[model samples]
Target: MDTTAAVPPATVIPHPSTAQGATPVRHNLVSLRRLFWLRWALLGGQAALLVSCEAVAGVILPYSPLLAIFSLQALFNLLTGLRLRQHTGRGARPGDAELMGQLMVDLTALSAILFFTGGATNPFVSFYLPGLAIAAAILPWRHVVALAFYALACYSLMLIEYVPLNLHNPDNAINYHLAGMWLNFVASATMIAVFVSRLSGVLRQRDAELNLAREQLLRDARVEALNDQAAAVAHEIGTPLATLAVIAGELRADAADPRLGATRVSAYLPDLQTMEQQLELCKSILARLRDDHETAAPQRIDAWLDGYVERWQLRHPHARLEANAIGDAAGLPVEAARVGQILTILLDNAARSQLAAGHEQIPLRLAISLDDHGTPPTLTFRVTDRGLGIPPAQRARLGEAPMASMHGGQGIGVYLAQSAAQQMGGRLAWHDHHEGGTVAELRLPAPAPEPLPAAPPPASPLTTNPR
Candidate 1:
């Protein structure tokens, strides 16, 4: 009897460098769990203190009401921990919507509890500010505004309704008591607002810096990949170029009499000339590849895509190429060389596959756009090919294995493209195009930089020869 039950299929886990949006969600969830535990511990300590106060002072301190409130808060904390554990354990990230919802609920509950337990009169009400601070630091501005409103409303209500019952005694001055309570409320709220606003600003700055560092990392990765490819390309072309050079040398050296067999000599002359020209082309290609290693400049999207598509068409003259731009190309930020390299690989693959299938023409399309809904916009570059679409099984493994042995058994180009995307703080995703082919989408965050003085116009053609 076979003892082996079929194993479940493995899930695709994106690398931290390549995973977008999800990384922050995972980070937020983990942070929330940590905060939850910290709050739980604090609440436990608060409970112990309440017990001590009730025992020694004989003052019916508000332990019962506070404990009951804390119980609900603890439940929410436990649920949050469970959700975070599930997310991290599965190697999957949480969604933004879910994260936002959790934050809102957590803040609302804490604020409500503070309002009910003596509002401004409660000594511990100030503790509630930290929760709001966390929300403002991580959430978008709109959500931050919502939290601000929640804080204002809760504090306002607490100031109006809370009144100490034993104010007529010789020791108690109701007016002074009310005045002190209002003063404390104003002070705590002011401190919380100032601290949270400042803290949120600092967080935003740090997040921007993190994004820039990630982009630089991507640029380094692309440079490394280009170096490797340049080496391989040189190796591949060297032998052919050497053979042609040798043949040209021999023909020139022979110098057989043109009078005895002019026709034969003339024919050989054309062949030699053709070989020399092809050898020159090879040498030029090698020179350009070498030069690329020296100056790895950033690229403009519109110009880069246009040039790449044109060069691809030159190699496969019969292939169809299409391009579309969705964002303003004038001021976009991207590494030109890396973007071009990625487009070239995709277009080259499509052309080769089409040629192999004996098609006279293959269609290729590229789209570039930006997503502006969030604080930092995201840039999207998509390349689609109307050729043999990748199978689901193979698509699943596109970026998993060493490019050399992925599902379709192709390597280098695809691996480099994927690597370049990640190095640039972006992701490379492959899906079936709606019109019956494969689409590769690269997504990156667009963080605006400090404005610099304009430089001289670029000398190189906006688009290079599509080789």
Candidate 2:
């Protein structure tokens, strides 16, 4: 009765703009992780190359300052790891500015090493490009441009600075440069491939999640609008329904009076009684609308289904329905009213379909079952009608929005039913029955079964006189 209850509150899903605003922070967090490991790999490679140059290439170079730069880079890397751990522990992530600062540090560290080894003449100076590439992949355009300019400044400064590789054989210098280029190519290629591809994957996944949230929010908005309309209509019709009930009561009373005469009284008595029953039913519906906010106690699945089917029969006395309950599982608690509304809509549709297909004589079948073997257990309701099965084109579009159906339905009820199903963490689907009709199935998440009471211990054996 309370349609708004099916739509999730705004607090559950933030606005689209808010989601967009948070994207940068998430992107920065992912970038920082990759940067952390990238720096570690660079440090290890620099150390290995330094050792090889000294032992194998026979190059005499300044080891003191270079080793000091490596030690400082390693220490900074340890601090970066600690920062990441601390932020993550508190359920926070590093921001874009922090990430930019990290890239700047790497650039500075590289320049310091290059300044000592051979400045711009060092073959590994091209490593600056890979760092810039990584920055571009994760950071915004403004941050990427800033990092680019900073790297350019470092390169220019290196060109004018000091420190040259001292080699005994000048002929081997070109060979070393060529070999270093090959190694740089391999390392740079690997770093870019691993980090950029993974970052792209993360970006793709985030986009997918955002899109899904946006669609869900849109659906909820539509449902909320529909609920407002329903509430208004309910309020407006209350007086008219009450008036009709009073009129029906007065008519019945007059029919019972002897002044009406026996023949006339008999003619109208049955119709008057039917009118009274229908008026009571309408009044009950309005009463439910008033108390929609109250949380009704859950009812056992079996009892609720039986009562619902009986009430449905009252609404459609002309259409015959065969209701069957199958399953041994007992005491499966169900949200009675909410589920009843969903099934009521389904049954109404089936009846309409039967009329449209000229099969009103065919008895509609309703089967209810409790399946405990499912992972979380499921309560299922199957409604089968020998009527016009859904068209292929309309199958996918059903319940998405209110559209005019071939069977003369406005489709608002189906949409509400679908939303209600989702709110209950359940599913509603329709398929062609094997017996040549449409079968609508509603699968609801059944509550966990109550534990069985422990058997009482047998009364202690009657006290023996020998004791």
Candidate 3:
């Protein structure tokens, strides 16, 4: 059952804006801290690699300058890591300019170490490729291009001027250098192909989800406009309907007067009946507008739906419509009135569209499917119609606001339908029907049954004896 406080008409509240077409792109810097941590680990590996080559392979390499550069990188990483650690969330994220600055520092240090070791001939020169790959993934295209150019300049400078490698045994230098180059190739390829690929996939998925959420928000905003219009229109209609009712009552009184002949009174009888019917229809319309249909208590949803369909059909006599239950329809709990209102809104829109197209009879179908195999059984209600489909211009713009057509139609039905579904922790979606029409689907979380109270405990023997 609906437990919400009553909402006054939307006329008082300013209409919501539906101008946002898409979610803005967000640059995530959560990984920047982790990248710093990785640098520390890689620096440790660099020290070990150098030690293994010297002690195990007995290569005479310059240790002092290389160790100095390594120590500098470790100190920089420690300080940077501590600074960035406090800003783990997006709010504290530094812009791309800051991140690019860090990458440039990393490139400069690597270049200095390479200049001392063997300049362009150093096997670790390939490490620049991984850094470039990371820049391309995280930075804008322009910034990545700049980094590429900077890296190219460093490589060219290294080729012309730098310290040469000390090959103690010139005879084995070719074999050892060749093996180092091969290892570099393997490491670079693995980082670029596997890690870069995974990161790209994650970014794309996040963008897609953001776009979907933005679209849903736009739909809700526009639908709210319909409520505003409905509230206003309902108030305006009261005066005209009252005038018509008074006129009808006067005409009936004149017909019953003795001064009027029996023949004249007979002629007025049929017209009087038609007028009374029209008055009732107007009253019904007003009532629907005033009551947002939240009064239905929790009960078997299928049964409520069955009765609702019968009433809806009577309201639109010329419309050919049918309701069906796809599975076992009984005992599933729901707040029937809200579901009914949502369904009615969808059906009304379809009926009006079909009538506008000059169709002699509007054909529509409401189908309910229930799946109880899972906890909190799910219910899917689909309203299918064979009317002219939604126009392309309005497709993306649907359900955001109350729009009107040149033919004096207020286009708020679908928006109201969607808003109703959202109230029940569900959603409404419009899709193209396979049979050349539109299908509005309402998927709501099934009402959960309340827990039964515990039975009273049996009287204790000692208490019974006191009694």
Number of clashing pairs per prediction, in order? 6, 0, 3
Question: Which one is best on lDDT?
Answer: 2
What does candidate 1's lDDT look like per residue over 134-208, in tens digits? 665667778767777877777777778753322224253454445546644765565456545655565575567
Residue-wise C-alpha lDDT for candidate 2, range 1-467, written one tens digit per residue: 11121221112445865756566556666778788888888888888877888788777778888889889999998999998888767767787789989999998988888888788988889989888988888788999999999999989988898588888788999998888788879988998889888999999988887887788787886567446535533632443455456657877777687886355556767666666656665656556545644324566654555556666665665677876556543346666666676777777788778877889888888777778887887888888998888886776777777666776566776776787787788878989878777988989887776543322322222111110
Please report the candidate that would top TM-score against the real structure: 2
Query: Which 10-residue span in candidate 2 carries the lowest summed lDDT?
Result: 458-467
Clashing pairs in 3: 222-400, 222-401, 223-400
Task: Indicate whether candidate 2 or candidate 3 has the larger TM-score.
Answer: 2
lDDT of 2 at 365: 83
Better of 1 and 3 by lDDT: 3
- Residues forming the 10-long window of minimal summed lDDT in candidate 1: 1-10
Shift of residue 7 alpha carbon in model 3, Å: 18
Which portions of model 2 show Cα errors greater than 4 Å? Answer: 1-27, 219-229, 256-467
Which regions of candidate 1 fall more than 4 Å away from where they truly are?
1-22, 54-59, 62-64, 94-116, 163-280, 293-467
